[model samples]
Target: MPQPTPLPAAWPALPTELDGVAVTPADRARYPYLSSSYMRVGTPDLILMARDVDDAAAAVGYAAGLRAAVGQVPFSVRSGGHGISGASTNDGGVVLDLSALNRVEVLGADLVRVQAGAIWGDVAAELSGHGLVITSGNMGDTGVGGLATAGGIGYFVRAHGLTLDLIRRATIVTADGAVHVVDAEHEPDLFWALRGGGTQAGVVVDLDLEARRIGEDDVVVIHQASQQIVDDLPGYVHAWGDLMRGAPREFTSFLMLQRLPDGRHLSVARNVWADTDIAAAQPAVSDFARLAPLVQHDASLMPYSGIVPTPRSPKVGQQHIQMRDALVDVADRALGERVAEALRHDVASLVELRSLGGIVADLPAPATAFGHRHQEVLVSLWAQPRGIAAIDRAWEPVEAVASGVYSAYTSDTRARQAELAWPGETGRRLRAISERVDPALLFDAGLTLRASAE
Candidate 1:
């Protein structure tokens, strides 16, 4: 993990060597791999390495003054930089780099304060030492700011609600550069919007989140398996979905239909038990194992931090990785066939399916800006796109039944419309809030939805 220093209380002088908060042209090359490898996109003309809350506010103020097109802002906010879409970075715009704002401190017995740029990996590692946990994304290297504002889906989804559910309050720098610590009792509307809302309103400095015990006593057993599917694929997929839906909330699973680096076609299932009680978890795990006998499995009894995946930084080179997502109910029979056929014809494409029925679906659709609570699964299709049209075609089958797309994962071209990322009444409400709060568009990081609009 990178060491982060605190900001000074009063104004210092120009780009000081102490905190190194300000990024001049000379600093760009050192921070090249801005985020973990998801895609090779975006190159900012100017990068403001914010050292603290004040620096982040100043960066947003400077960018807001750039004066760009009618709809788009001239700057983008980069927190974790794990966004699959290159929204954090831009072709020729400025980037409000929040990396140095990484601070995680336990405020009380049940609450912790985390800065926007803090990585989930570092957060989890720190919490494990304290015997505490917060539901963040499955990947450790994901940024706290990006997923918290967007919907944060994680390994503990079955036990805890979405990551945003744990957020008690947040400190944000709005377009006008004023700092506001918002919560349900504070700025109620912004608080509501911030929960699972897109990052279109402002730059979040740090968040105060509710914490839970995830000590060794709270051991979680995870089973992961993958193998070539030599049998009937459609029936297998439906059976897997059915088994997962009927299982206990403690048992959450993710399935990936992909082509290996070799020519083999495979479907992988990674299921988890959210409790320490092994006997109570065995039945659900057993039912899922029957869905695919060919897949080899692995199980573990470990703490919450143990489940965080290894480093998720991008690879050495910039590769063209194109991905799309859809929130859907149970897979239609035809869609399964389409996926199977697609898998056979194009081994290069992959489909990832994640279960969503635990606390995620239990929440009201209007509770947050995440529009897919009614959905049972999220199907993410990946391809090394030759072009946009081809990627669209491969994703069509799943999208036909899509409730909506997950804003954090999809490309700007795919999730551009307000309705696509946040559907129904949620879309209308989000835009109204965004328009009211930041009309000048200071924080319009892609897949934008504002709970403030006319």
Candidate 2:
């Protein structure tokens, strides 16, 4: 039998509470599965699978102790293991895995208790039976902790606002290992920070969300449209944006635009009607179909759960692409031209534009940590990870026109990115709270406000 990898000499000992769930490299059976996230591969020195809130607290305390004794340690807090920023895993550090703490409980007609480790798809499925829906990301496999803590731009964002907006209460373990139950009434500062401040505030174990009533049975109309643009990509993009912005709150859409190798452009839109009213949704759906030259169009009224079904897949960092995003107030011709120009650089593989307005815009900017409520569109640039410089150059212009940044969609976690995600007053408040709660900056993974604060 092979011996387990020995712990580093300078590292602090693991807490006894975490011994049963800890996986070192020598535990080859479980180590591989827990070592990587959706966008990046990692070889963590220790993976602590927290069984409960107490275990989660213990993990934080252990990591904090290590940081105090040995200086900066790469500590990551992972929920579902599917993090686009790739901050959930790290090389030669500690990963506090909360996958085992997943639980979805319906406490009331509109209130639901969801563990951090629960996937958005599973939460949607559980709520579907009760005719309740919570707006989440496009992927069902995304962890609730990551999305709810960040900003959730989903198909119903125009109708329901962000996932963070629905957070009624949360249980978190801060850097000091103190378990805090925060809500609008209690620990208001931490509650404000927890909603959209990422993991910098602490490791959230679970959240109680106020789910929205979708209808009689969580049913909605899903329209998928495809267009082939042979010329003038900017014109078509602008038209699609116009239609989406003018559409009613009941409608939301996501557009993926890419240039094919044959010198043509492929524009696909996934449109969602927040209700089962087919007649009311057809007009906007029709407008989307006519954007370029429609090649395919499909619309069906189905349960919202069907749109975000949970698929069990292991995370091996299969998605190794470089991603950058910007939030803009309008998708006018100028923005469209900028997107086209970026693609022409041959560095970006594609660009995604997600509609965000309607009810989302109704929220006051200071309502939460995600203060870019007025931005109507989120533009994301994707590349093959050829070189950071090339992609950065390609995305520079687009970022110049953007009003804000969505941390979840971005891969760059540097201080620059942090400055964009939490800019000005928001950055100042989050920095103050972080300093008070985590003075040593032990929980400094993802977009670090501490670095930006400096």
Candidate 3:
């Protein structure tokens, strides 16, 4: 086994209050498991496993103190350690690990309180009994803090809005070690910034979310189908887009395409109907199946929790690929052509198209920091981590037609991506808020408003 690395000479001493929760590089067994994330490998000098809001505040205060003394220090706050950009972990930095703070509680008939460290799957399981569900990411392991604060585009995105839209209140620890429980009525600016501005505003410890009631059975219909694109890839893409554009608000679908070595594209689609009513689901599901010749197809009814089952596995950087995504108001033949071009250029190993625009568009753009409420589709690409220049070069076609970027889904943190993530007036407001709440940029991770300003 490799030996533990030493901390930087200038690294500040750990606060005595945090010693019980701190994990340094010296702990071989535990340190190795906590040092990395789902998407990238890291070797953080210290990992503070914050057990509560107080511990979270202390960690942030400690990092801020170090930055004040040394001018600059790498600091990151990690919830589930599943951020696609892998910004949650860093080499030779301080990681505020909130995994131990995971907790889910139902506050009322429709209100649920969840700790930042809790995974979406666990939240679903807890809320299942209540006959309520909150729209979160498709994956079970995604952290509540990261997705709820950024923007959650998932299986129910069309019926519900983004995860950020569900947040009624949040408990955040700002850079100055100040804990604030913010909502639309209290500290509204910070609350707005927290919803869609990534983590630049502060470290969110927990959130009070509004959950939507489902049927008595509390199940949704899932239709999964796959086909081999032997020819006319663009046509298939266009038809798929057209179908979704006309589909009912109850229908939401995600299509994944990957090029096989045999020079054919393998297309897989996951379609969901927010309700289990077969009368409303069958026609839309059939329309999607008719988009292409399917090699396999199946439909099932399952609890929302069934799809996002958590593995609770160790973080070892298992996903080794770079990802980029954009939100477009229209999914047309032109968009399909551009996606085909990107795939032909070997820019991505996998490309995904998720249908949006239902209740998601019901909210006005300026309602929260997560503008782009009018977008109709979310397109994402995944490729081997072959470096950013090459990926960006081949991604130009798709990016040209994009109206916005989802920062949480992309690994690119360049100024351009940041600008796309928060554009025009939205960018301006977010930058102002970040400067006020986190002037020292202690919680700077992923695509941020400060990066956009610069």
Q: Which candidate leads in lDDT?
A: 2
> Candidate 2 on 59-134: residue-level lDDT in tens?
8898988888998879999998878779899999999998888899999889999999999889888888788899
Quantify all predictions' global Cα lDDT against the true fold: 0.70, 0.85, 0.85
Kindly list the per-residue Cα lDDT of model 3 for residues 311-357, writing each as its tens digit. 88788999988989989878877887888778876658878999998
* Model 1 per-residue lDDT tens digits across residues 1-454: 5343322222222333323554433454654655222454655545678887878777766566554322353467778877777677776556788877899998978699999999998888777777678878678878898888888777777667778888898998877878888988898778777776657657788999997775443334454444535366677667777777787887778777876556445777666776667788878776766665565666667666666774756522264666778777776455576666556535236787787787787888888767667777777777766776666666666677776788777764433444677776887887777788788656655667542222
Model 2 alpha-carbon drift over 4 Å, by segment: 1-6, 452-454
Root-mean-square deviation of candidate 2: 2.1
State, as a TM-score between 0 and 1, how close model 2 is to the true structure: 0.96
Error of 2 at 400 (Å): 1.4
- Candidate 3 accuracy as lDDT: 0.85
RMSD to native for every prediction?
5.4, 2.1, 2.9
Give lDDT for model 1: 0.70
- Ten-residue stretch with the least lDDT total in model 1: 5-14
Each candidate structure's TM-score, on Cα atoms with residue i matched to residue i, is 0.87, 0.96, 0.95
Which candidate do you rate higher for TM-score, 2 or 3? Answer: 2
Q: Higher lDDT: candidate 2 or 3? A: 2
